[model samples]
Target: MSFLNYLRVWLACARYSTVRTMMFRFDFIMWSLVELFWMTVNILLVSVIYRHTREIAGWTQYQMLLLVGTSMIMQRLMMGLFWSNLFELGRNIRTGQFDFFLAQPGNPLFMVSTRKLDLDGLLNVLVAVSVVAYSAHQLGLHPGFGDIVTYILLILCGLIIEYGTLLLIVSLTFWIVGSQGIEGSYFTLFEFSRLPKEAFRGASNVIFVWLLPVVLVSNVPSKSIMHGVDARYVLWLLGVTLLWLLIGTTVFRRGLRRYASASS
Candidate 1:
């Protein structure tokens, strides 16, 4: 399909979701309030910590707030856009809907992925951006116009890396195991990505920083805006994001082949 057509379908789905959400006005309000409340709690937590110390993991309270807000924005947007679609892969396979996906007109993965949008996530993303702006002002971080553009691009890159990680984990459903068990463990480790990289030490640092690289998701993006990102770090971040995307695509393709043959 043409790019415009693809966009039309995606937007239609998003529009439907917005309308559906509007039907339950109270639930939507409650959910939005809950997310905002947690965002406040995150800021308060950092404030409480900063009372005793100047910084955690080399970040002042303002910087920490920005990082946490970035994480919340990245995660909330991703989960809103793709989490449900990706996680449903296993159930679809188990229940024999995988074949139906393959028969669809567009890219199977793309078709399945964009079917749902968490309209509520938009509120949280806005809250996150507000926090970032407020914290930057408090810290006297008047980033240049170019710097702001770079930060937004880096945040997008970080979001892609986050999505790739989710795809890589959820694609394991093709291999056949208790999907729930795997997802539980995946989330347990993934949740740590929310914290500043400084919290990690020694082997843990090496593993998560260079290997899994979830630290780059929020921490590096925040740093890029504050300290400015070097070309080498940008290259590394782009490389890792592409690597995960390739790995996820490759694994899913292979798994699909095996599944098709088994079903036949």
Candidate 2:
């Protein structure tokens, strides 16, 4: 399908989600508050930690707040846009509901991932951005237009990495009986993204920083805002984003080929 056509389909799905959310106003409000509480706890933890120490892996409190906020933005965007659909993907595959996407006119991955929008997640993105802005103000950092653009671009790269990682994990459902445990592990692994990159040492550095894109996703973008954009960091993040995207799509397609529809 044309790009415009795919966009139209997504808009329709988003509209349905919005109407559905309106019908459960209390549920929506409660979830939004829950997420806000979680975000507040993260900020408070940073504040409390800095009370005892001056810096963590060279990151001051506000600097660390920026990192946490950056991670939140990418995650919130992912949750809002693709998490619900992806979370249900494994169940759908197991129940042979994967056939629904196969019958759709659009690309299956796109159709599946874009079928729902979590407005609460999207709403929390504003809160995350506010945290970042407040941190910037506290740090007395005035980023230029180019720097702001670079920061936004890097955030987008982080979002793609987040999506690719989750998609890659969920795609394993084709071979495994269920991906429930693995899906939960996704959060466990990405939880490291909020930490300062310099906090990792030895094997932890090798695993989370070099091997996985978890640290790169949030740290690189936050660092760009703090210390100005560096070509090396930008290039490394872009390279990893592209690699993950390639891996995610390849695995999903391979899994789809093995999928057995309800009919067959």
What is the per-residue lDDT of model 1 for residues 155-239, given as tens digits with 9 covering 90 to 100? 7887787777777777787776457656555456656666888889999898888898688777777888878877777788889
- The per-model lDDT (C-alpha) reads 0.79, 0.92
- For residue 79, model 1's alpha carbon misses the true position, in angstroms, by 1.8
**lDDT (Cα, 0-100) at 257 in candidate 1:** 77
Q: Which candidate is the best by lDDT?
A: 2
Q: Write the residue-wise lDDT of candidate 2 on 107-193 in tens digits.
A: 999989999999999999999999999999999999999999999999999999989999999999988955566787678888999
TM-score for candidate 1: 0.91
Q: Identify the candidate with maximal TM-score.
A: 2
**All predictions: root-mean-square deviation over Cα?**
2.3, 1.1
User: Which ten residues in a row are the worst by lDDT in model 1?
Assistant: 181-190
